[model samples]
Target: MRAKIVFASMTGNDEDMAEILEEDLLDAGLDVDTSDVSFTDASDYLDSDLCVLVTYTYGEGAMTDELVDFYEQLKQLDLSGKYFAVMGSGDKTYKEHYCENVFDFEKAFLACGAKELIAPLTVENAPTDEDIDRIDQAAEELANKLNG
Candidate 1:
């Protein structure tokens, strides 16, 4: 199966998480492509069987400038039959807005007729071994979905 991973990061935490997930997915023997949200074309998402978003919440649940454009592009597409997952990094100190970008991406995908393959995954500030384990589990689940 084919997959695409798109990410937006501040301070590299979100990108790191994406890399780990990419490796896990690659090892599962699926063809995977990854890009930063700023640089990806909307068609890249539509062409893939699985699309995953990895991003960090900007101030007060806002997406970054790049992701704002990416999200708007996503709103214009009809992604029927696509499968998606969301993972991200955020600080828990922002009680009301922590990892809100992940949910925003999930909502965008659903609005465009994409199905979610897994619950959103969020890490506080940075990932720990526990967080990596969770990411691995998510990758395994995605692999299962692709294989099935």
Candidate 2:
């Protein structure tokens, strides 16, 4: 199976999470590719059997400008039969908006007809050991769902 991870990270935390998740998925025997949101084309999403979105919520729950174009394009695509998962890092101090970008991506993917393989995962600021473990478990579950 093939998976694609697209991410937008400010301060690198979300990028790190994406890399870790990629490793977990790879170890589970799926081929995986990743791209920065600024560099991703809408076709990138269509090319994968599964897609993982990793992003950070900027102030007030906004996604970074780097992800704006790709995010818009994702909304226009028909993602039926694609599986998706969302994970992200954010500052919980924001409370109301913490990790909102992750949820935003999940909602958009669902609207475009993507099926979710796992619930969204959120890390506070950077991923902790527990967060890493959770991500790994999610990846394994995703692999099982696709490869079973």
lDDT of each: 0.91, 0.89
Model 1 C-alpha RMSD vs. true structure (Å) is 0.8
TM-score of each: 0.97, 0.96
lDDT of 2 by residue, 20-139 (tens): 989998999999999888888867888899988999998789766667778889899999999999999888889999988889999999999999989999999888899889988888
> Each candidate: how many clashes?
0, 0
Q: Residue 10 CA error for candidate 2 (Å)?
A: 1.1
- Residue 6 deviation, candidate 1, in Å? 0.4
TM-score, prediction 1: 0.97
Cα lDDT tens digits for candidate 1, 1-148: 8999998988899899999999999999989999988889777887799989999997688777898899899989999998999999888888989999899889999999999999999999889999999999999999998899
Model 2: residues >4 Å from true position, as ranges?
none
Give the true-structure RMSD of model 2: 0.9
In model 1, where do residues sit more than 4 Å from their true spots? none
Locate the minimum summed-lDDT window of 10 residues in model 1.
Answer: 58-67
